[model samples]
Target: MNRNRRRGKKLSRALVTAAMLGDAGTARRLLRRGASPELPDAHGTTPLYAASVQGAADVVALLLAAGARPDTESGHGDEGTPLCAAACWGHAGTVRLLLAHGADPVLREDHGTGRAPLDWAERGPHPETALLLAAAVSSRPAAAP
Candidate 1:
C-alpha cells in the first residue's frame, strides 16, 4: 500500500511507523497530511516517543518542530516520558534534542514507577549519557511558585 494513500487513523499509525524507522520523509508527509506527532500507538507511545527511543534524531527534531510537546508522557507510568525513553536507550543526541525542545528531566509524571529521565538514563550502561542527563537535570531552573 502506498503510504501517501493512507487516511485517518491509518495515516497516524503509518506516521508512528515512519517515526520508529527514522524515515523522516514519510513522517514529514504524514504530518503534512494531518497525522499528529502526538498520536500514540497501541502501547501508548507517541510518534515522538518512538523516534526518541529509536535514536532517530532527525525524526525527533521534525516532531519537535511540528509542535509535539516535549513533556508529553507515554503509558508506561513514570518511565513513559519521551526523555526517559531516549535516555533508557542511551540515545544521547535524542536526549539533548528533547532537552533543547523543553523536555523536563525531572518529569516523572506517568511512566510506570515514578522514575525520572535521569533515573532511566542511570539504569542504562551508558555513563556518558547518564552524565549528560545529570547535567541537564542539575542545570534546570527551579520551578516558580
Candidate 2:
C-alpha cells in the first residue's frame, strides 16, 4: 500500500479511538491531520458513532463540524444510527447536538426488527432524551408509506 494511504488509515483508526475515548484534543489534532470523520474503524464503527455511543459531546460536536453525518449508521447489524446510539445511552447533550445537525429521530436500525431512536431512548428510560426525540419526530413530516 502507498505510504500516504497507510498513514491516512492509521490516522483514521486513531481518530476513532480518540472519539471512543472522548479525547477531544486528540480527535481535533487527528482531524486536522486529515483523518476522515466518516471513516469506519476495523469494527465498522465510525468516529461519530463511537463518540455518540460514549456520550462524548465534545468529540461528537467536533466530528459533526468536521463533516460527519449526524444520522450516519455504524457498527454491525442492529447497532443502529448515531442518534439511536446517543439516545440509547441517554446522552441528552449528544442527542441535542445530533438533532441540531439534522439527525432523523425516526430513523430505524439497519437490520431486522429495526427500532427508532425514540425506541432506544425509551428503552434507556431516559425521559429527557425520549422527550427530545419525540419532539423531533412530531415536528418532522411523516415518512412516505
Candidate 3:
C-alpha cells in the first residue's frame, strides 16, 4: 500500500472506532490532531455517516462541528448520505442535527433506490420523526413558493 492510502486507512479506522465507541471527545481530539473527518473505511463508510446510522448524536455533532460535511455520501451502499442513513435507522436526533447543519433532504442514492431521507422517515417507527420529515417535505419550496 502507498503512504497516502495507509494514512487514509489509519484515519478512517480512528474515526470509525471513535464513533462506534460513542466517544465524542476522542473523536474531536482526533479531528484537532488533523484527522480527516471525510476519511472512509474499507467499505467506504464515512465516520459521520456511521455515527448518524448508529444514532450517536454527540459524535455526529462533534464531527459536524469539526467540519465533517453533512452532505458527504458514503462511497458504499449506493452513495448513501448521512441524512438518509440516519433517517433509515430511526435516528431522529441525528436526522434533525443533519438537517439543521444543512444536509440536503431530497438527495437520492446513486443506486436508483428512490430512498430519500423523507422516504426513510416515512418508514420510521417513531411518529415524531415521521411527522417532522412529512412537514419538511411538504414545506419545500416548489420553485415559486
Candidate 4:
C-alpha cells in the first residue's frame, strides 16, 4: 500500500481502539499526538462514529470538541451518521452529546433505506431513546415564516 494509505489505516486502528476502550483521555492524547479523528476504518467507521456507536459519551464529546466533523458519514455501505449509530444502539448519552454538539438529526444514511437518526431511534428497542428524539425534534425551532 502507499504511504498515505498505510498511515491512514494505522490512525484508523488507533482511534477505533481508543474509542472502544472508552478512554476519552487516551483518545484525546492520541488526537493531540496527530491521530486523525476523521480517519475511516476498513469498515468506513471514524473514531467519533465508533465512539458514538459504543456509547462512549466522553469519547464522543472529546472527539467533537477536538473538531471532529459531526456530520461525517461512514464510508462503509451503511453510510450512517454518528447520531444514527448512537440512536440505533440505544446510547442515550451519546445521542444527547451528539445533539448538543449540533449533529444533524436529519442526516440520512446513503445505503440504508435512507433512515434518519429519528427513524433509528424509533426503531430502537429502547422506548426512551425514541421519546428523547421526539422531544428533541419537537423542541427544535420551526423554519422562520
Best by lDDT: 2
Pairs clashing within candidate 1: 76-111, 76-112, 77-110, 77-111, 77-112, 78-110, 78-111, 78-112, 79-111, 80-111
Q: Per-residue lDDT for 21-120 in model 4, tens only? A: 8888889878887788887777777888889888999999888887888878875665488888888988999888888888877768774458888898
lDDT of each: 0.84, 0.91, 0.81, 0.82
Q: Rank the candidates by TM-score, best first.
A: 2, 1, 3, 4
Q: lDDT tens string, model 2, 50-131?
A: 8999999999999999999987789878467899899999999999999999998787878535889999889989999999
RMSD of 3: 2.4
Clashing pairs in 4: none
Candidate 3 lDDT over residue span 13-33, tens digit each: 888888877788888888877
Q: How do the candidates rank by lDDT, highest first? A: 2, 1, 4, 3
lDDT pick, better of 1 and 3: 1
Q: Which stretches of candidate 2 lie over 4 Å from their true place?
A: 111-113, 142-145
The parts of candidate 4 lying over 4 Å away from their true place are 1-5, 111-113
Count of steric clashes across candidates, in order? 10, 0, 0, 0
lDDT of 1 by residue, 12-119 (tens): 788889988999999999899888888776667688888988999999999999989998886554237788888889999999999998888788856444778888
Q: List runs of model 1 lying over 4 Å from the truth.
A: 1-6, 76-79, 109-113, 143-145
In model 2, the clashing pairs are none
How many clashes would you count in candidate 1?
Answer: 10
